[model samples]
Target: MIRIVLIGLWICAVALGTLFFTVKSHMPASGDAGEKASYLGGIDYATTDVFSVPIMTDGSVAGYIIAQLIYTVDIKMKARITVPLEYFVKDEIFRQFYGSYSDTKQVEKVDFERVRKSAIDGINRHFPEPVVRDLLVEQFTFMPSSEIREMNMKSIGKRLSEH
Candidate 1:
């Protein structure tokens, strides 16, 4: 019985090897459809313009956080990936940022990936398919209300001084 099993295994291996070589020889070349093929399946990614989201605390914009995100989706869904989606993405990132650290003052110091999964899920809601391969926080700045006011005041002052 052992000898018979060994012979059968050897024959199966040889057959598979022969089939592989035959198929390989007849297959199309690598570059034949390179242009038409997508590196990441058939999905293309869209990037959102830099946008800021309000970090709410007690029904107010406790802090402002800005982020640029990237997503992979079908081209047909480009329109859906617009302002609404941008707002959602920003909200998601803010939720993660705020939940992890209540105070936005430590936004830069807080670790983002801790809430990465949730943030990614929040962003992926726009796409029916889970095409969000990853979420990248290209730019993240967490500024407290005071700083924003100060910046605004400075800009106003600069304009007034110039005039």
Candidate 2:
């Protein structure tokens, strides 16, 4: 009876030890998840925003900019945005910023300085409570109208040749 009880307890101990080791090995290490890994290692997100700025033809501003004619021109653009994992963690501010930026019609270009200032101001204003270590802009491309047409033509030619 003593031998059996000792063997049973020994088995239980071994089992518990194995289970603990397995769980600990499988669990993520501290700061080893998601954007933390990328940010810490200096690996930037692969994302971009592409847009066009219509140049002023003649002296008159484009109809889209009649009232809003500031130092900057209106640009039609397509953005390839990567939502950082950190941003997703911010429920309220993230939702507001996401909603505001989702509209293609609302996209416009201001002076680069103005844009920079506004972005800095926004970060200062909203991110005070939360600890965000880094926000990175991975890429920005300006797609001209001519380049679009040329790319379309090349794509079409390639398709025709393939067929």
Candidate 3:
């Protein structure tokens, strides 16, 4: 009975060690291929939300903020932008811009032309030279005003916490 118990314990230890090693070996390192793919100016995948403010005729600004999400499947490949949010709010726009829509397609050329120039202008202000080859919006929808307010609240909370 004692011998059997000892053998069981030994088996468990070996199994655990093997499992740990396997998981560690498969883990991605900072300098690995996956990390390399995430760097800017390289062929990497990134998804981020962008906000645009549209000026209304009455001197009051309304947000035509679009949540721009993109994914690069291959290097130097034309990635798809999925617009998941497109809504006109009185003041601000806040919502998850991706994964909320069923459609996944590129933004129309006319729409792209309008937004791209604005985006380029915005980027140029911060960056000395433009880095983006093209800008595309995959999916677009509307976000509620309440959502934008909530996001503002959250930002305020964060700032308060930092101090």
Best by lDDT: 1
Candidate lDDT (C-alpha), each: 0.68, 0.41, 0.46
Per-candidate clashes come to: 0, 0, 10
Which window of 10 residues has the lowest lDDT sum in candidate 2? 69-78
Candidate 3 residue lDDT tens string, 1-163? 9999999999999999999999998776756566554654454544455554332323433323355544332234323323211221111123222222232222121254655545544433433333344445565544344577789999999999999
In model 2, which runs have C-alpha deviations exceeding 4 angstroms? Answer: 1-117, 123-134
Q: In model 1, which residue pairs have backbone atoms overlapping below 3 Å?
A: none
Task: Give residue 136's error in model 2 in angstroms.
Answer: 0.9
Instruction: Arrange candidates by TM-score, descending.
Output: 1, 2, 3
Q: What lDDT, from 0 to 1, does candidate 2 have?
A: 0.41
Tell me how candidate 3 scores on lDDT. Answer: 0.46
Structural RMSD, model 3 = 13.7
Q: What is the TM-score of each candidate against the true structure?
A: 0.57, 0.33, 0.31
Q: For candidate 2, lDDT tens digit of each residue in 1-163? A: 9999999999999999999999999766776585665454542332222222332324432212111111111111002223433333233223323334322233344243544345434543443232333333333233334566788999999999999
RMSD of each: 15.4, 13.5, 13.7
Regions of candidate 3 where Cα sits further than 4 Å from its true position: 24-52, 55-65, 68-138, 141-163
